[model samples]
Target: MTFRPISIFLSPNTEKDDVQLASKLLFKPWLWKKGKEILKFEEKFKKYLGARYAFSFNSGRSSLIAILEAMDIKKGDEVLLQGFTCNAAVNPILAKEAKPIFVDVDETINMNPEDLKTKITKNSKIVMIQHTFGWPAKIEEIKKITQESGLYLIEDCAHSLGAKYLPSQISKKLRRAKKLCGTFSDAAFFSFGRDKIISCVYGGMAVTNNKKIGENLKEFQKKMNYPSNFWIIQQLLHPVLMNYLILPFYNFLKLGRIFLALFLNLRLLSKSVVRIENRGELPSYFPQKLPNALTLLALNQFKKIERFNQHRQDIAKLYKENLEKRFILPFAREDKNREPIFMRYPLLVDDSDKILTKFKRRGIYLDDAWRKSPIVPPATDLKKIGYIQGSCCEAEKIAKHILNLPTHINISPNQAQKIIKLLLNAQ
Candidate 1:
């Protein structure tokens, strides 16, 4: 049997008009990394999320750092965060010299609100909630708990760009409000990384409803040096190149990851460019400002995010209908009036090595592991960060078994079925 590879990123077909629009940035090199595009991106993003304030950054890790800087989460402070998320989210806590307290996630792979309540202490100053894989974590309950405990909330909306939070209690003001995923918390951040819902290749946004947090982010931005023009050009043009050339040959791309590891080791590639589950020490470039051209690159995709995300939902619905009972699927929390972006459909298997090998031979690709760390980056010893073992047992177990399959809009219904068939029969 001949195998057809499926892709989650690099799935979208290239549009000539989109390419022409992007070319406008290259034409005017003067505006390549300017404040004008950055301002425009923020304004439009703020309006779209209905957020009062929005600021762009070079990466989500930078946005997280600015949020912590704003909250004054310093050494001796405890930041309660779920262990089952990207290490980028927690690195900022350490950058602030604060200790991170691990919280367990529920079946949804989101921070369990019950576990959140248990982790808070007098030293706990902030709580970072990740809307894992576009699933809105128990937002209302967690928000209420954080508010009562006097902990500031930072919604890591990187995986959930358009995912929303529907309030259970609809008061007069709440009735008119749209509780988008990033807007529900004190301050939130979104990523435009290579694999995010809308990839601008490299960028992030810091958003908030509070004026003080906005000012703090601005102060942080003032200190950041702009990214290199070569890097900006590379990031700007990579998306279309990916969609047109690389993604179709994803298995080859998977093989190329070994070369990437070599490049990272040789220092030919920036460590920040490719994230690893166990990259021991973070690069010093965590907190940086966005380039004007990259913001323009992000804006082009942002305009089409809603449409792109809809296709993702259609694919997810198909997977939900077809893959049931065959696999231990991700959380399907009810009463979620908002739609999840469904970045990828998560699967929990007993033996990941068996599943990964079965698909790799068949030319199907899956995420290495949805972070194989109870405290993401399994190599990081909790004792080093002042966290204890046995704090989040479920996270450690799930990390070992969990992997995500592609749900890119490019996946045809027939292709999706092929994937379902493979996943169902793999074990």
Candidate 2:
């Protein structure tokens, strides 16, 4: 008997429009006027985020490097980051020739604000906070610490787009309060990658209210080009060919390892590793050029972001209602009045390895997302600053015990129920 496979996460592109547009663009090469599209996408995205400026890039990592470059973050400067996050978040700090100071995460799975204060030092120049799994960090407390210490705050909103965080008491008293997460930071970056809440197949954006950073990013964009036409064509065809055709073969044949190895070996999928300048070495900054095709794809998908976010929110709610008892759920901050567009539904469980094995036997897939700290040698002194030693203890425990069920637009209620039942049984 063939069992249905349940994946942990899926891109939000159920509509056939993305593929149709890709096909149209492929046929008419002249229609690939990326500059105009990129600018329009950037403007719309900026407006969506309520940010003053936005710039598109080939990937989230590149966008992050661009943000660090704009800020002039140099070698030896310590940037505080959460221990439990993707390499994309940490690699950029390394690219800037800076050292990442890994901080503990609170109950929300975001950076611990108190820990952030202790990490601040004379050498610390920036604090990079990720809104982990769509939960916003304690931005108000973090902002206060940064302000008092004269440090820069950079928000990594890779997991959050439609998410909102309410103003703090201080911010409310000021009458003109800043939004949490992205808005609280001096600059922020977002991803529209395949596994993200939004999907452009591959693309990212950098945003800021700071005029200088925006101008720098714009100047860099002027010199860059999109990925080649060949890449764009492949992306256009992937949804139909890879998702439906190739993926099924791999699943049926039980050739996942072989498939992954082959996929990684392909030149198109090879990782791009670029060395970034430390704080002071560059004469003039120019944003590195990314493939033009990615920019075009991101531009096309920017319009459907709201629908995508809504779907994710709905699915998250379902997971919460179904799985809350057996696992510890990460919820939107109660004090902050923001709705999160959950990128991943992370659950803390007991005996993760055993539960994962059980789920796998039942044809369910769960991601071991961000298990390793990308920052070389994770920080050891976070507790000195009153950071709860076990702040991210839940995440760390869940990282081993938790299972991420399919929470995408394509997942049916039946599929979700099946997953919930499995978890309940496991418990």
Candidate 3:
């Protein structure tokens, strides 16, 4: 018997305007004006994030590498990060020939500041914090610790773009709430991949308050050549294929990942381009140029971010109202500063494998997003630092037990309810 598949996460690219704008890039090739469009998008993203400088890159991973490179972190230096995160977040540190010191996560699935504080050593140079699955990390405590230790704090806001952190009491009474997550850190990165809330086909951005960092990032971006024209054409066609033929087929046949992996391996796939990393050394500069088409597409989508965020928020509410009683749902911060536009609705469960298996039997798709540990040295005392050691126990628990119900803008409330019911009854 066929069963309805409820995916954990889905792209929120349902708007007609988004579709039309994306099509324009495919049908019409106007490279000359793309730069201006990119700049416009950067400005809007910066404004939205309350960051001073926004630099777009080819992908979120590339942006992470660019930010680390721009910061001048080098070999033997240690960058503290959550143990549970995508390889993209961890690989860049290794690419720099720097050590990635893993830290444990708190209930929020972000870096535990307590764990972070313990990991700080003389060799520690940067603290890379991830806002995993759209839940905001405790930036206030992290900011304080990083400041006192003189360590550069880099917020990995890849999962939580529209998410906001309220000002601390001191900041609120004093009217001096520090910048948002991306702005709070020395640098932060965001992704605009196909599955992200903001789908620019494939793109990423790094934001910072330092003008010098922005300049350095731009210089590095300029050195990297733009993506090939053929690749740009492929990106332009991704949304059309994904929304119409591909997604429908996957949904109907319950072959989302099988088809996705096959599609990704195709030579024509726009995101297939790989940048060679110089082993055991940090490159002094980036050797790539952000694709003009990516920049233009990202810029155009920036205008509609508010609407996109709202949709995510609505979905989050539905998840909370429906799923929280049965699962460990995330709670909003007491501080009223900034509410999160959830990137993914994560939950903690007692038995992940069992839950996942049950869901799979029903053709419900709950992704175990970013289940690996950062490829850091084995003796980094990651567990001691509370960076849940042994391959992201927190992330694994969430991946196995937690279900990412379909919460995209395109999914109807009834669809979401159906997913919640399946999960609720599964237990």
TM-scores for all predictions? 0.88, 0.83, 0.83
**Which stretches of model 3 miss by more than 4 angstroms?**
1-6, 9-14, 32-34, 169-179, 251-262, 270-287, 332-338, 357-363, 371-400
Candidate 2 structure quality by residue, lDDT tens digits, 223-302: 66656665555555544443544345544656543554565457333222222221212212123343444556665566
- Roughly what TM-score does model 1 have, to 2 decimal places? 0.88
Which residue pairs show collisions in model 2? 74-279, 75-279, 164-338, 226-291, 226-292, 227-291, 227-292, 227-293, 352-401
User: Residue 296 of model 3: what lDDT?
Assistant: 67
Q: Ten residues in a row with the worst lDDT in model 1?
A: 271-280
Error of 3 at 12 (Å): 4.5
Model 2 alpha-carbon drift over 4 Å, by segment: 1-4, 9-14, 28-33, 169-181, 228-234, 248-250, 255-264, 267-292, 332-336, 372-398
Candidate 1 lDDT over 1-427, as tens digits, reads: 3222565444232345555555566567787776687889999999999888888898898888888898877788988888776667767777777887889989888899998887788898988889888988888888899889988989999899988766878787676555678988899999988778876666899999898988988888888888777666655455444433444444564644454455445544343334432342456556778888877777878888877788878888888887767777875444446667788778777877777778767776664445466665556555655456678888888888887777664668788888788877876
At residue 397, give the lDDT of candidate 2. Answer: 50
lDDT of each: 0.74, 0.65, 0.67
Sorting all predicted structures by lDDT, with the top scorer first, yields: 1, 3, 2
In TM-score terms, candidate 3 sits at: 0.83
